[model samples]
Target chain A: MSTTNSRMSRKRFSEPLLGIGGILLFLLVWEAVPRLGLVSARFLPPASTVLVQLVNYLGQASFWGDVGQTMFSWALGLVISIVAAVVLGLMIGSSRFLGRATHSTIEFLRPIPSVALIPLAVLLFGIKMESSLLLVIYASFWQVLLQVLYGVQDVDPVADNTAKSYGLGRIARVRYVVWPTVLPYLMTGVRLASAVALILAITAELVIGSPGLGKQIGLTQSGGAVPEMYALIVATGVIGVLINVGVRIVERRVLTWHPSVRGEGIA
Target chain B: MSPLKRIAYFIGLPVLLIALWWLLTLGPTNFFVPKPLKLVETFWTVWASDRLWTDFLPSIIRLFIGLAASIVLGVVLGVLIGTYRWLRSFTEPILEFFRAVPPPVLVPLLMLLIGINDQMKIVVIITGAIWPVLLNTVEGVRAVDPVLSDTTLTYRITGLARLRYLVLPGASPQIMAGVRQCLSIGLILMVISEMFGSSSGLGYTIVLFQRGFAIPEMWSGIAVLGLIGIGLSFVFRGVEGRVLGWYHGLREMQRDT
Candidate 1:
């Protein structure tokens, strides 16, 4: 058993290292291809150039300012969505009659792409950040709400009965038992929504000409500042990566007891 | 709830909301919030003038073309990656990078390289829509039960026979789910690509109206697009239900436990 365990650990360690090596090889090729002139430098800049441009932008005050605005709107929109979705989701999910009544309506509205509302938003809010916030809320709210509804539904009935037997009232039982059980699902929904919100926020700016990083990227591109545009795009990609990684860490910390998370480590 | 009560509750709320909306707009709100009745009137006017069909057709056509192409390419690539372990190892990071990078960010790069035209719009839509299908297909194929695979091997099934009998059916449900998601996302990207750059399509119509300060006309275009989204979702759900009835049965069985 000891030998088997050690062998398993060794294999796990080496496997991820192999995966990392493969990724490094891909990046190396990407950096090399443009420098070799195999692909046009106009279309595909070298990775080193992109890195340099990224560093230059990092030194700018406006870059951080844009980042702050984008993050602020994103967080505010996400907070509003979570509050609204969780409250409504709990009310609807706890009652069979309410769930049945609202399910069809939710289904109808849920599939409408929030991006399609950019025009209506522009009409309603003008080229303001309010429009972006509204769009993010719309895009993300339904996702969390649905996940919450499902999470509530997945609560074990016996556990509820057991809590009741222990003299817990409905609200207390829900607070102690149902909330903890569903918190993992809630976190998963929030993680998914975080990514969606970032995309939609940037998308809102891109389409409606809202003042954000997306607008900055658009300005750079149209002004033929190719390297800067590429740099800004790379920065946006980094932001996405950072958000994903940050959310994942939070998810891991919050859902430490979850079977899926407990089953694997970053090795 | 009984079916009748459920119907009443569902239908009544939206009606009440609409009535409230109409009431809110009646109190001299001008361009900020157009009256619901006025918006309806605008819808009729737009439909009557035939700008609706002319602008809408290009968007729909482009969307369908992009979706069709992406579905074909994503499935092929997904299957290839799934079937070959080495390929999966090589491609996973690239897939992760592309999936994380929002599609609209690519618009500037694509426009710079390819020029702003129908092809560029189509390419953007395809790139936006393809990843979900591809990733899901890979997962679906990878998740094919090893026991079933071993059974196929025991029967000496190989190559096309193995794929046809074992792999395709195993992945069909996930593939369908991926297609549904891609279609929804593709529609959004389609409209967005047009809104950002194109001179034609429903998106362009909305932009045109908004820029012209024709709030009513813009609302009409948005309403029509919303209906299209609703219609597409319903159609896909129906198709998915029919195609994956067995999967649904299995799901129900699992739920019963």
Candidate 2:
């Protein structure tokens, strides 16, 4: 509505005020929904109940363990994916012939939803963290690999020619020329892959019964601990927000030199 | 990159992989690595059964409904927020929080209220897929050139005409990208939701096959999933090519200059 009009300074942060208002409104509704008997309190449980559970969970060592286990899998899976994707993406993407050759294979493999592999993971590793890692790594690998490929391919041929004219060696060319241009894409990939890695980690734990918050959620659900389940779900949402904001900060800080990050007020 | 040569090169790797798989399963094939030939036979056998229809169609249909709902809802809300700066600000935090809640995590919560059913599955899919579409649409709509708006306004182009001629085309490329992402996310949620409680669908069928020790059936289910995955993306690309041809052309022209 303000697209054609110039806005005054007071207008800038007003929306966030509205956002705060909206969240407060939502919490009010969440609190009221059960208390007002809109739904059975036994079924929906009041937001207060869930919040109390969340507070209680914060004190429990096992709750902390679940959080730690989740973070560990997420970190480990992300690291494995980043290493594999970057190394393989760089190697394959550097050689024009190899890149072209792998295009079909990449297209074929990229779309296979990782959840489909849950049963396979289960058959292989059962409910261990490896089961989660298998799906997590496979899902996130494509996100990073594809980004790396785009990053490598995005390297200017003019820059390539200039580097060749200077007789730079293969590894040197990549280190000096390719790395700078691709770093932006690589960072983007990592950001995207990080989100995916988390989602997959949760899904794996929930579906395959791997050890994490997801499994905990499953446990609470079947055990009829509705408030505790909601608490765990909220805990997950909090982690997701933190992961997203954390990644955004990291990307902004790391890529301060990149024009997109440097010039943008908005991500 | 001639068509024939491209096709040849494309088939080459898959063919080679298939051949290698056939070779690897030559003697005493393990339970995990079903012989390629045996898998093919089992795939057909399963496909011929009524179970195939029950599992396959519902998964696709649920995913389709979810993707469609998310796209429509996302585009509407995204455009509204993007165009209205005030709306964008107030809702941004809430949207961000909702998005961060992984869709699958909602399955248990949803199951408690809604029970294990197709509706629950569809809702989960919507939750998972909506983020990309909404975010992308916001970006696309927000990026619409102020100059174009001015031109359309100066020409006395009103409301529907302006939106048709100016806004939609400008925002389409990004919208398409979002839809592509949404499709994949929706598919993932569809399968995950099924794995938990439902009686049928690809996910339920796969988990069922797995637990039942029907490895061949499980393999077929997973194989079908891969095919559906590729098929959906391929179709998305084709639709994108048609819809965004103008955007592509404009970018290419600018590149040439």
Candidate 3:
């Protein structure tokens, strides 16, 4: 038993070590390619140089400002989309006729890639926060809406009928029977939307030249700041990783009562 | 459930929305919002010309190439990593980091390294679109039933035979999910790469129209992109239905029992 426990512990320890070793190997290769002059040092600077630039960015006020702009757009867009989608989803998803009437329209609109709206966004808003928000909202809204619609549809007919027999009002029935059923799906939607909103926010800034780290990266590239451009890209990657982790944590917490979450604990 | 009812349910909302747009834009108060009819006319004139071959065709070809490359690379690498425990551990963090990085963020760096050309655009799409396929494939491969694997081992199945009979089919559902994501990412990257420092493509032409203040033309371009997106999704559904038919049958059998 002790031997098995020790082996298990050792396995856990080595897992992350393997991951770290992989990253270290990657960094080493990156450092070598430029240092050994195999590739142009100007374009692909040594990994150390990019790391140093990333550290420098940490101390700069302008870097924080850019991060703040990106986050603000992301948060605002996500919030707006969630509010709009939840309300509309609930309304449309509750009625069979309404759901059918809108199914084809939603199908048509949902597949329209939000990036295709860049021209309209640029023309209407022109390198402003609204442009980023528009793209972010459009891209993420469908994600949440679809999930919410499915969730509402999944509400148990027996439970709903039980509530109706008990003289529960429409609002009361929704609060009691429907809300619990939909929470899990809504959580999934939020997780998907959060990542998509961040991507769209950055894309809008990168392509439309809005004020954010994406714009900063674009400026650095244009200005020939090779290391800085790499640094900003790394920053964006880190942000993406952190956002994913944060949403996952939130999903777990919010869905603790969900069977899927409970099933994980058991298995 | 009748045919007429289905038609009405599907078409009613869209017709109403278009009619509303037409009514609202009748006075021409907002210059940015073009009338639906005028936009359609501009779309025909703009795309029916040489731009169809010069811009739209190239973008489509690049999209297809990038998607094909991502599928081949992602599936091959995913299977190798998934089949070996050590490889899975070693590559997990690196894959996660790269996947998290918005594909758009890589555009500038790729532009610098590869120059603003067709090759660069294709590479951008591959980098962005590859992740979904690769990650999903890895998960799918890993989820192959242990009992089934043991059975294959008992039969001494190995290499090409094993992969063809077990591994590929087991991982295909997840692979299809990845491919679905890959399609959208490829489309987005194709447009985005063209937007940056390129002379001709769908994205470039749209930007050009916007900059030139050709409002109707720009709207038309966006409409074309939407049509393409819808068309691709239909093609994907057709492919998915055929590919996953056996899996669905198995699922139905399980539910029945």
TM-score of chain A of each: 0.91, 0.94, 0.97
Q: lDDT, candidate 1, residue A51?
A: 78
Model 1, C-alpha of B154: deviation from truth (Å):
1.5
Predicted complexes: DockQ each:
0.54, 0.79, 0.88
Interface RMSD for all numbered candidates: 2.0, 1.0, 0.7
State the lDDT of candidate 3 residue by residue for B54-165, as single tens digits: 9999999999999999999999999999899999999899888999899999998998788888899999999999999999999999999888889999999989999998
Every model's TM-score: 0.92, 0.96, 0.98
Residue pairs in collision within model 3: none
Q: Which stretches of candidate 3 lie over 4 Å from their true place?
A: B253-257
The best-first sequence of candidates by DockQ reads 3, 2, 1
Of the two candidates 1 and 2, the one with more favorable DockQ, higher being better, is 2
Deviation in angstroms for B87 in model 3? 0.8
- Which 10 consecutive positions of candidate 2 chain A have the poorest summed lDDT? A1-10
Chain B TM-score, candidates in order: 0.94, 0.96, 0.97
Of the two candidates 1 and 3, the one with more favorable lDDT, higher being better, is 3
The lDDT per prediction is 0.85, 0.90, 0.93
lDDT of 2 by residue, B1-257 (tens): 79998887788788989999998989886888899989999999997788757878888888999999999999988988888877787788888998898788999988988888889999999989999999999999898999998898899997889778888788999999899989889999999888887888888888988999899889998999999999999999999999999889999999999
Model 2: share of true interface contacts reproduced: 0.82
- A1-267, model 2: which lDDT tens digit per residue? 465344543566576688898788778899999898999887788888889999999999999999999989999999999999999999999997788778999999999999999999999999999998999899999999999999998999999889999999999999989999899999989988988888999999998889999999999999999999999999999999999999999999988888897679653
| TM-score quality measure for candidate 1 | 0.92
Candidates in descending TM-score order: 3, 2, 1
Please state the Cα-based DockQ of model 1 relative to the true two-chain complex.
Answer: 0.54
